[model samples]
Target chain A: MKKSDVIRAVFHSLLQEAPNKVWQPQHEKGLGFAPTNIALCKYWGKRDIELNLPMTSSLSIALPDKGALTSVSLHDQSYDRIILNDQEVVRDSAFAVRTSQFLDLFRPQKTGYLQIDIKMNIPVAAGLASSACGFASLVSALNDLFDWKLKKQSLSILARLGSGSAARSFWNGFVEWYAGVRPDGMDSFGEPLAFEWPELCVGILTMSEVEKPISSREAMQRTVNSSLLYGSWPKKVAQDLAILKQAMQVTNFPLLGGTAESNALTMHATMLSSWPPVCYFMPETIAAMHKIWKSRKEGLELYFTQDAGPNLKLLFLEQDKEQVQQLFPSVDIVKVFE
Target chain B: MKKSDVIRAVFHSLLQEAPNKVWQPQHEKGLGFAPTNIALCKYWGKRDIELNLPMTSSLSIALPDKGALTSVSLHDQSYDRIILNDQEVVRDSAFAVRTSQFLDLFRPQKTGYLQIDIKMNIPVAAGLASSACGFASLVSALNDLFDWKLKKQSLSILARLGSGSAARSFWNGFVEWYAGVRPDGMDSFGEPLAFEWPELCVGILTMSEVEKPISSREAMQRTVNSSLLYGSWPKKVAQDLAILKQAMQVTNFPLLGGTAESNALTMHATMLSSWPPVCYFMPETIAAMHKIWKSRKEGLELYFTQDAGPNLKLLFLEQDKEQVQQLFPSVDIVKVFE
Candidate 1:
């Protein structure tokens, strides 16, 4: 249903009760939300999403404090209008279709004000888990309005319905999402590690480029099917998972870093060797890694791990932040983000 | 000085001293001898050997029975005389100089009856390690006839002086050369992995064509002086050596395979990324790897590897040899060298 009709109906109903007050939905208030997450170990290929059979499972942490929160409200009034820059605007079909699919479950009636303002500054839909935050926001808004009071884990299911990675954002620190083969999707979700593994510090080195990323959805599908090394996927992932879990327990940097980096390379190489190669690592990305390894040889506790994006996420000592920052180039814009 | 001269001198020297012996140097030796390694793991710069250091510290095995060996002797007769094809033939400076060097080391007379003849079935000067076996034969003939009793290790040093990888031909199985920093050429040569780790099985797959390889000497020099990744050399070699040694201890096939394969890619990548790129993999070689990986996804235990050459060495269980062989388009001509 159109936002105008929904807004008109909401005000119409409210007008019935008060016979005077009128309000309308605003575009700035976005309706979806999800938490932020970084995979300690990552999942690559999927064996079966029907059962969440992941090629590999990874440990991830959810960021809550700085994450986005979405708010949506419906008000009556309308000229059957959509607006951009205070001017009429039209909705995109695919996006609208996707949003409508989720909105239908919460509000069967179209009458309402539509406000969609996403407050979090964290990037979404690229390497970072932006969709997790966005969808989480949407799901949360629906839950808040309906008084669903769903548990965090239960809400994650709804968030995941929009994007698979959202499940990781539901949990706090270090969680493992098992890529199991059980027929029901319920078999795989977030299970947190201990509340704290104090020695962990991850440094994100975002490249300077702001160009839109090739959507992960399309890349992953292409890599999974067209990579020359595609067949090694499940087996390699299975092997990596066993080692990854052990590394998390012991916090073995070598084991953890080596496997993580190699897995990332394999993931990227899948794209390079695809039938139609797709390169996401910019010259900056390659240079950043070179510098990190060069620094690593100098006895700094620095290791880099990448996730599908050009940004170089470095894992280093907390004490070495400033020194590490000094060593890094192309990261001119730095923010002390958690 | 050249092939013809070396052949002539050796021919004459053997006829003079040994009176009727033949000196045959093996053909088909390899040059790219890096352990299975990666560029990211080692060198990085756009320059060369300087940046990435050496593309590899390869581990290889020499064919004991199949490669060539020669015997030579000198006798008091006329000027240096050469005999080959069962007849006295004109000797050139190419054969003369190399044979003369060996002669000077033994029977020191400039003019003497030297009888030397070479019988080699393997392709001469091919990337197949022709130089390896050839040089080893040259040194072996010099050592044997004169009762120099040179140790295999000593012969390796001499062979390496002749060509970086030829020295490795003295051994039969898993061997690695330590490319170290002792300046007077003291710290680099191949050594065998101790016999305790005997599970090492090498599969030698020969590409149909036999062409010249980038002499490890030229390639290493280029890599050491020009590659951007040069600084990472010591650490990379240290890391690969340690990892490979560990793999040796546990005999982990997949780890060893990946490490070796990645190393080979690193070596080649550095070459291609050089000012002028050179490729060692053909479409056929790529196809072979793809086929093997395809089989692996279907649950096969076959593993394949390659050196600087296009030949792909495939390893499989004795039971599955036939099945594994069938995957390649060239099974009919594939020679399984035990």
Candidate 2:
């Protein structure tokens, strides 16, 4: 059968169950999986909210097959319901409200109510970009169910409206988010890099499984609004992003590791400069960083990056993964991307 | 006796023991005590090395009677000797070398050697600006012994040659260090505030009594050379200083405290952005900050500022001192400043 005929047949089946003016399927479902991306060059602040535009361009490596799996199914309920990890999410909760709002972006005007079930293997709110994976997977699944026929780039644009970092999750391997010029953000989307470093390994030093006190969105807004050192962040990120991209293209491990670590520190610097200062480094985090530095001095070839929370993500080559694992015995080894 | 006549007589008496260099003086002595100043608006990075000029203007409150006391006496020996806290400081030590270099700035073409003794009650190198008080006290004592007839501004300038923060220590109450445009840096010195907030109270949260791993000088140099966020710091500091001065003039505790805390955080942010990132906040330092924040949220008017080390200096009203002291059981109530 032709691809168009397959899509038409699926839609015809989806419309069979309705008894009213518009028929709807009781159980038409689509599912998708997407992984979170660890930003080597951080995206800290925004230029516009309506278009979800970033103030700085960023580079990240996608962690495939170790993120969120989301399923969307048409239901008989009058309102949409969200179930997270086998539990019904409270409708008035911030997480539920945010997830519902994100889904509304894809809801067609005359569509029937749908139920979303998100199963996250990655811990949410642990500075691991679980939201990014969750939203990306949800968008992907909804697109598949409705036969939206949206291209990857268009999917990325839609995902960014849910979360800025979610846009980068649509791609595989290394991805770059362009800090586009248009006010409408028509040009802003993630693009996979031309080259890939297959030997790269990542070790996630998860400090806590609990949710962070301050959300990344709130932290970014605070830094943008009040941090004294925030003025030059965009230009600094741009410079680092250029250097990082070149290093990645050439597979320069030292350059890539150093640039990513430095860029992460620079991002934290803006948070530290915010009024009442947002400090995320716990004692364990500092100790972890010290161990990484010590290992590097002893020729282990390892570097680390931190996001808005206390957890750390260390990057190294496949040859040095064992050594990195030994040095941080407390941390979990994330093997999906490796 | 007349002041000039008294100075001459003192110098004449010093000539009794000195057989060379035209027999200047033998027993002339002077003593001074000066407390360190905590920069409410931090002075980081430098504009000039030779003259010790600051990159940006800063404000501070001198903590009188809570620092170092030094005595300088003319001696018959051919060389000068320094004894700190009753122990002879080694000539090759950084402190000794820096002190000698500072004294050389005061030496005329031909002058007799002197014996100096310094007693410091405050902990050294723990981010309490011990050097500032030590150098300021030494300079003040030397000025009196030699009858230099220097004004407070001139004394501040001389003291700044030893330590940048030392210039602010020369004044009682509040002080400001001007980041001068002059190449010679003659105009860059500390000036006392015309108005004073006598009812203010301070609590020093001393996390460690030991010396810090990295000195402020080395940390500042690292930040200036490598920190990506440091590019726009001077301008930000200048803007904050203006607001701080206005707040001081009005005796507005909220403005003064808030600005001080924000400025200190901004200063540390630059350090955290350095290539290796000179982060000084221990877990206790963060805890102290949180306590202050919590108290503030509970309706207490309190704020905090930190210098180059782990300690936190809290600013509050006299009425709030007891309550503030109760919150942080480990903190020291600095009665001298209050």
Candidate 3:
């Protein structure tokens, strides 16, 4: 089935026969913000590509300030206009194309057009989850502009139509995205966990800000299709999701950090086993990982998780921030709980 | 069961009621040579650690001339004397200890001592399967010294008591080790394949000569014990073994190269998913892999397989030797079927 059908069905399920009443615009413009998330238990494979249904549940921690801010308004022009970081995105660019296609799902009979302005604090398409926060904020802004009054859960499901991980970007703390079993994916949405540890910190070791050679969508698809080792990924995610939740609930930094790092490495391991192999690791990435491993061996509570790109996100407690920074001189530290 | 018990049982089963008949030395000194091998379908986890029985069968191609040569003689010294490449191996060294332990299995009596001298053309403990050839040659030399006149299958089983992969180093061409079902591991041994491809070449891209921090034995055990993704490793090996055999029969270079590379990466993938994660890739190893991938994308028929260390073995044909050499200027190329 098409993505639009899934979106409509989900909206109908969420709105309960009031979908038509919320379609009309209540405001001329609306602004929304979303925090980018790093998965502790990664979402690697998808069960339904059209609906962005994950094969297994995942947990993530949202970075409070490093994300996307989007503003949306009804436009009278024949075509929707998109601006990213105050720069006009060309009509045919991949970013613009994907944004327009997602907007088409909610365009109200192809007659209504909307102008979107997005400002991201993180690098785009560099494995920093730019698309995730961007889609989430756009959905949130649209909800406000139309006065849909949808809950965060409904908003998360809506954002997932654009990108899978966007489902987890709707919350500012620990969020868990359920891998719902239904074909329509109505039950799949992000829910924030109750526990919070103020001392947890995420350090960004940006080895490269260049766009990834292959998109995560393409990499995930190839891994699922060709990697023999991908068969065990769902099991890995299930175990990791449990460990992550337990670690967070008890404020066990080492348990949480170790599981997150292992989960990320397992995801990359599957990619490495794929045919034509999807290796996102650069030489510099390997060098940084060795340094992190060595420091950890030397009684430092530092661990790292890599995404679909070359950058590494280090997980450590706030107390070790000075030491972590000292070891990785150029690291940018983010206080997650703050 | 202990390793010694397994060794004794295997010898008893192979000799069958007349075990003492072949114990007399036919010659004053015995010499033997064995070639190192590269696995096309890797053997990762073991079903029985003491017997070294693999969880799945594996395929490999022996690299002629790049291996170990060993000479054994009765010694008058109270302790067994061991020399590797003209240097006396320190008595307490891991290599010497393992070698002496294996030698104890064939001492005939507790008081008998033997002097062993070995020469290896490849680097030790650098993922070049040096131990495989070393153990295989030692067993072959012991067989000659005792005039056992055992078949290659029996010798393979004896070699396995020293190192698992040594079971495949008895021949100089394609070999397949069976993961047999017997509890005693009598059926598990290496057998030579009938088909041969003289055009096949293995190019060695040695990124590091340093000894691996963790031995393959420890890595394999940890992966099996802690890695969730290792559950699928036997299935992967099974699939790759069939594809490799088929590819070899038809001389399908791409199919063989692709399967071999995937199998090796899948093995490493399992290691990467282990707790505390085993990463054999150095920075230079990753840089070299990227180069190989880029070159392949640019129409070079280059493929690579990595073992337990940072070295890469490039699989190409004789026709692409010049191009592969040009791509990796420091690569040492060897003809597999020579």
lDDT of 3 by residue, B1-338 (tens): 77677778778777774577645667888888999999988989899887899999988999997999999988778778899999998989999888877777766666667799999999999999999999999889988887788889999998997899999999988999999999888999999999889999999999889999999999999999999889888888888888898998888999999999999888999999998899999999999999988998899888999999999999999999999888889999999887
Q: Candidate 1 chain A: minimum summed lDDT over ten consecutive residues — where?
A: A78-87
| Best of the candidates, TM-score | 3
The positional error of residue A67 in candidate 2, measured at the CA in angstroms, is 0.7
Off by over 4 Å in 3: A1-3, A13-23, B1-3, B16-18, B21-24
CA lDDT scores, all candidates in order:
0.52, 0.79, 0.90
Tell me the lDDT of candidate 2: 0.79
Q: Candidate 3, which CAPRI tier? A: high
Off by over 4 Å in 2: A1-27, A294-300, A335-338, B1-27, B75-79, B108-112, B336-338
Tens digit of per-residue lDDT, candidate 2, span A205-298: 8877778888999899999998878898987887888898789768799999988998998888888788767877776777677777767878
Q: What is the interface RMSD of each candidate, in Å?
A: 12.6, 1.7, 0.6
Arranged by lDDT with the best first, the candidates are 3, 2, 1
For candidate 1, give the docking quality class from DockQ: incorrect
**Top of the candidates by lDDT:** 3
User: How well is each residue in A116-232 modelled by candidate 1, as lDDT tens digits?
Assistant: 445666654447666566667766665565445556665655565565666677665666666545434445566666645455566667774353356665677776775544555
Residue B320 alpha-carbon offset, candidate 2, angstroms: 1.7
